[model samples]
Target: MKNWLNLTAVAASVALLVGCTNNPYTGEQQAGKVGVYGGLGAVAGAAIGAATSSKKDRTKGALIGAAVGGAAAGGYGAYVDNQEAKLRQTLLNSGVQVQRDGDNLILIMPGNITFASSSANITSSFHPTLDSLVLVFKEFNKNGINIVGHTDNTGSLQLNQNLSNHRALSVANYLTTKGIAGSRISAYGVGPNQPIASNANEAGRAQNRRVEITLLPPQQ
Candidate 1:
């Protein structure tokens, strides 16, 4: 997100610079088209920066993502966003600390609510959210549910990935027992690559120690 912000700033700067120039592409220079292009490019650049790791991939993926995004139902997207926000609030009210980013929701419960250092056994305390989600899945079955696990960047990357992966699988397994189709849900442990908070600060580290649930759009 910070990277997105920076790209936006850079884009604005470029737009300002281009406004003062004569258009070489067209015989008669027009600032209006250039401004529109620059503005759009900035927005695209920011989105790309947030979603991709490499420059070329970011540029290509950003354009493709934009086109696909245009085909997405605007009202449906907003409705889904609102539902996700409501779900996040409900989880928070249930005494779970949640991080909401678009359709991706992250929750970090205390050890009492989850498993030990490297185990996938979700504690009894966390069952309520899982059960609640089962109900949510039934109601909003359009999107695929993705269970992801993360740990503070404290352990070996391989071990961390394994732990997170197991944790995700455990929750997915539990959901399957509740009648959710296995194909409707997927799980992965990102380990430290997608930490929302800093690993340096204790408070931030606590935030990093969490599980993520991502909801993807309906398939065609």
Candidate 2:
């Protein structure tokens, strides 16, 4: 009973300490993937260690497990952080918005800048921006790329769905041509189903028509 209590206390302490960190971009305290993964790992490791070790060695086992688990999870956080920094620098003033959601990085490309109106064809001027993306993507090859196309509700559902899918495919094809591995890429379309803004006005409709490239870590 005492050994179990000790293990629980250790796990809780580690989680609490590692869970809260300052966000570099926002300069505010945010609960990020580092905290989430580290906490989960510590708990799992503690339970496993307690179950496997002899009574006399239980505490030592729990400590070692917690350390290993925390470190392994924390490494993923560092990997994404570096990649985000590179992307922000590379895409500055390029009209692409870089957003961070936990360990994932989302690159939002507005349709007006990326493709012709109501067409799947990419704009000629966007090639340079994409070229810059290719350079960074090639350098950060560890992440999986997910290309999703969204459209405003200006047409029938079927039409919007087909158009969105084609747009997503076009972006994926472009990336593949620039040396990004086909195996690392997946493209899909949500049409007007996942709009970020209302379709009642042109401004909001414009916001809805976009292509999003989300970068995922290996663990995700």
What lDDT would each prediction earn against the true structure? 0.66, 0.86
Identify the leading candidate in terms of TM-score: 2
Give one digit per residue, the lDDT tens place, for model 1 in 1-220. 4544554555555553454445456766655333444555556655754487475465455544443332232335445655665666567666566555544444455433577656789877778877887887787777777778888788799988888888888888998999898898889888878777788898877777777677776772
Cα-based lDDT at residue 24, candidate 1: 53
lDDT winner:
2
Give per-residue CA lDDT, model 2, range 85-156, as digits (tens).
899999999889999987789999999999999999999999999999999999888989999999999989
**CA displacement after TM-score superposition, residue 205 of candidate 2 (Å):** 0.6
TM-score of each: 0.58, 0.85
Query: TM-score of predicted model 2?
Result: 0.85
- Worst lDDT run of 10 residues, candidate 2, spans 8-17
Count of steric clashes across candidates, in order: 0, 0
Clashing pairs in 1: none
